[model samples]
Target: MHTEIQSMHLRASQKQLTLHTGVYYTGMDDEAHTFCTVSDSLQHSPSAIWAYLTPVLDRIKAEVSDVDTINFYSDGPATQYRQKGNFYLFNKEMADRNMKQATWNFHETSHGIGVPDGVGGSLKRTENMSVLHGKDITTATDFVKTVKTPDSKIRIFQVTEEDVKSKIIEKLKLQPIPGTMKIHQILSVKRGELWYRDLSYNSMEVHEHQGQHLKFFSFWKVIMLYSICSLH
Candidate 1:
């Protein structure tokens, strides 16, 4: 959903607040999890994304202990989810969390509609209704408390200013990956390693690169060769 701002009422002055939503499916049951991460920070950068996702992943892991691999599906937006920084985090965070393997699949605009959109719309309406009913929600914290109900399916997590500051975004040492825009799929089977392709196909040829070390992945691979880069 669009970034939810404070003072949602039209007449009230608004401050930009972000609400990042993810719909998780485990396939073990019919239940669906809707995770909403609210943050006061206006940043939509990779570090901000991590600040939002870390808590959601923690909750997911606590409930789904047996799962190893994760597959992410989203519309590619360079600054938010499709940049080199995100790729670095994808590999590093998965390894840090002890996940076996993972894949991030990007869908074009027309094909990107999914459950997460519905979750966002529903919550937006909920927030609007709360405001209409004279409920005060002037901050991300207020928004979280307002929407949280005992029987509600939506799980809420808050990302504080401290969380953003502690991310050390400036020191991430991220370097842009080539053809990042054309890449629709990124796969990681091991720590500090990733395989990316413009299209997702099982029979497609892949390449590897040599020489050089990286912080999270020892090497990065594409359809042709694996290249090495370093990050800390």
Candidate 2:
């Protein structure tokens, strides 16, 4: 089930509060769908907000200092967080493509580094993240989609600990890493999640993102973390 959308809110009555706004899809169906946003005197998470704004804020903070709290407004209804000392906002796009791209403002700006170059009727573009294959793995939105569509598989599996030493290995045609038997125990599959969970309930590192609650591993990073985790 989808999370309920809540009303837009503004942080109230604060002096020297900073504001940062970010856009996120959260897999919500349409542009007209409510947008979720967040801000902090510090930073907080399910981290969906960091999808765009964190990097921008890092840059903005370098320049803007007087701001201590932020103000937030959304084009429509949303379930978001706004505290007395911070501000955030979300804009609803009238179109889909822009709405989609709006969500990746960070990944695009930082990693994509794309812009028009003045020339003789010409333009130029450049991108880094050379370690990446064809796309990004840092953004949860992008990384979560990777395992869903493997080169040889379509269905995403919620592999259990038992499947770690056998099922995933056999299916992927990989020999088990010598001591990685308990690897799966450290990783809760990504099925229907804000993100995956490690064996520890504290598996994911979202800090007090919710008042009472709340939740990637990479393939190589995945293998390494699990390998070390298994030694315990």
Candidate 3:
């Protein structure tokens, strides 16, 4: 499983607007199906991306019931899935679905390439051709209506501000894992425990859930102190 977040500018009534897109692809069984959503906002923050992603994942899960382990490949962008908050959400999803293990692999910066790029490019080119042919794609609804293909697996959604905001995961109280900023390859958190490897480390550190929970309490105390100071 791989996903990519992309943004495009759409023209409507001579006004320019932003549309955020999430593309998902699974290259199994020699057949690739693409799932996507388009939102009229540039705020493709972690929450927004999660909102668009969860449903697509659920659909995939239903279809591929025999698969026990799932691997996600994505580009490392801090504001998006390559962060702690998204990791928590991913863990919760795995637990809820009863998956054995989930691994997320981040492609090295500037070296990320694959099905996502092709999907995004194909959609954009199709939309651009419609525009060149005098098709009016001014609204999210308009874009969806105009960009349909007979054999396309793409499912486009028109998202709203409230829809995106509702998807924000509750902030975890855990402290940042040491050396996360230097992480370049893989981050795997299974069943509430965390394991990570950075470019400088030869081996991954496995942090137990109990120890991490203790650190969470300590981290919460500091946050409470800061909140109290701001209240003064």
Top candidate by lDDT:
1
Off by over 4 Å in 2: 1-46, 79-232
TM per prediction: 0.79, 0.18, 0.69
Clashes of each: 8, 12, 0
Question: What does candidate 1's lDDT look like per residue over 1-232, in tens digits?
Answer: 1344544446444676888988888846778888889988888887788888989888878888877988888899988888887888888889888887788888875885678788788888998898777786768988888888998899989999778666544654455666778777787778767777776544224534321111132333431142223321
Off by over 4 Å in 1: 1-13, 201-232
> Which RMSD does model 3 reach against the true structure?
8.1
- Residue lDDT tens for model 3, 1-232: 0122233333243433344444544535666666666666556676777666766777777777666666776778887767766666666666677777666666677885676777777778888888777776766667778766566777665666677788675553544556555554343335565455543222344444332211211233545766677789
The C-alpha stretches of model 3 lying farther than 4 A from their native spots are: 1-28, 170-174, 185-191, 199-232
Question: TM-score of model 1 relative to the true fold?
Answer: 0.79
TM-score of model 2 (CA atoms): 0.18
Candidates in order: C-alpha RMSD to true structure: 7.0, 23.9, 8.1
- The pairs that clash in candidate 3 are none
Among all windows of 10 consecutive residues in model 1, the one with the lowest summed lDDT is 209-218
